[model samples]
Target: MTEIWNILFNPLPNAIMTLLTGMSLVYWLFTMLLGDGFEMGTDADIQFEGADVQDVDMDADTQADLETEQHVEPSFFSKAMDFIYVGKAPMMVLVTLFKFISWIVTIASSLVLNLAAFGWKSVLILIPVFILSFFLLHYVAIPFVKLYKNVGYAGEEAHEFIGRLGKMRSTIQGEQLGAIEVVINLDVIRLNVKSKDGSLLSYGDDVIVTNQDPNKKFYIVQKDINLNNI
Candidate 1:
């Protein structure tokens, strides 16, 4: 067992790879546990609803897949991330997967290349290892995320959610915050909502999505006046 441990991660090079791989795994575990509470993919260019506007060409084939989500420009780092997946799942999940795969490859190569004995010479092996693993995963993630999106998990896009009916999950009184649950394409999703008119709404009151925040993070909603009349 000790021998095997050393083979996977012991020497300085292996130690670095193991650390990278471990960080990725730990992060994903936290994401799974924390769910939406944790912002795992801060670097991811895409969101659950759609791609950041400027980073995406908008004409790309993947854009057709999202059909209903909002569009916005992502940060520069996120634009680089666009080369990978376009956000079928949370960007955090994709980022973690990419790191996990790359780190594993880096570790494996370090062992096989026997860079442990080379001292400073290992840098030669490490540089190319990082580049190859990074790009390799970037290209591979596109198809994988696309496939994940296709088999269900459709229609939770921002564009489609706008104008959809949702029930307030909490009370909101004038410029305060609330949550709304709406069904889009038969899928129940939730969003942070605010009233357009600063009107008060009670829990379970019906509301309509009137607009989205500039950051596209949440919805601006209004109480459905006709709901009470009906």
Candidate 2:
């Protein structure tokens, strides 16, 4: 085990993989130990029937994933992520699998080539390892995506967001566009938004949707007080 850890941390590519996978392990450990008290991916809780927004714990990395969800630019990059079932399962989970697979491939290839740690042969080893990781990631994630859907997670249409209460994913002021997180049907969704009155809305500030732009440019929002807090 000591020799294994040494090799994993020595090579450049393997080192990166080890770091990412190590973080994933820590995240999963926290998720397991804390149970329902700690939800790594629950962005914002919403009560649609009574119309209320509630505070939920979320880490920075998961929040970043939600912020960019369904909003990635450049069709190719977006399509590539979709190809690997990114939206179906948690992005971080897929990322963890990708890195671990890459690390395994790199280490195995290095052994086959008799490449020394931090050696030139290990440098060449990265070429095929990087490519193989993607294919493996694509196949390995299939079961996870199905399992995620088994939990009844489904995204709703944008029109359903009107009159919904949510929290700001980023600061929005005046005409500048930003993101707001809302929950519907047990799925967290982020939509482009702008403060209705040109006021500054910072992250985690409660907001309610007033209306949506005619052309679907963005949602018009304003500060909202959570009734549950009163």
Q: Please report the TM-score between candidate 1 and the true structure.
A: 0.46
How many pairs of residues collide in each model?
5, 0
| Per-model TM values vs. the true structure | 0.46, 0.51
Kindly report which residue stretches of model 2 are placed more than 4 angstroms away from their true locations once superposed. Answer: 36-74, 117-121, 154-230
Model 1's lDDT to the true fold? Answer: 0.59
Task: State the C-alpha lDDT per candidate.
Answer: 0.59, 0.64
The candidate maximizing lDDT is 2
Cα error of candidate 1 at position 108, Å: 2.9
1-230, model 1: which lDDT tens digit per residue?
99878766655666776777788778668756867433323334345453233211223443443333323333555345445643334455566666667667767776677777887667566678667766787766776656544432322343356777887656676766556666644434546667788877767788988887887545788877793647
Model 1: per-residue Cα lDDT at residue 181: 64
Estimate, for each residue in 1-230, the C-alpha lDDT of model 2 and write its tens digit: 99977788766666766787788888778867876322323233432222212112233654475455424243465457557865455566677788888878877776676666446446767777878888889998898777654442224222267788987767656666666667664455556677898997777788999887775546789999667645
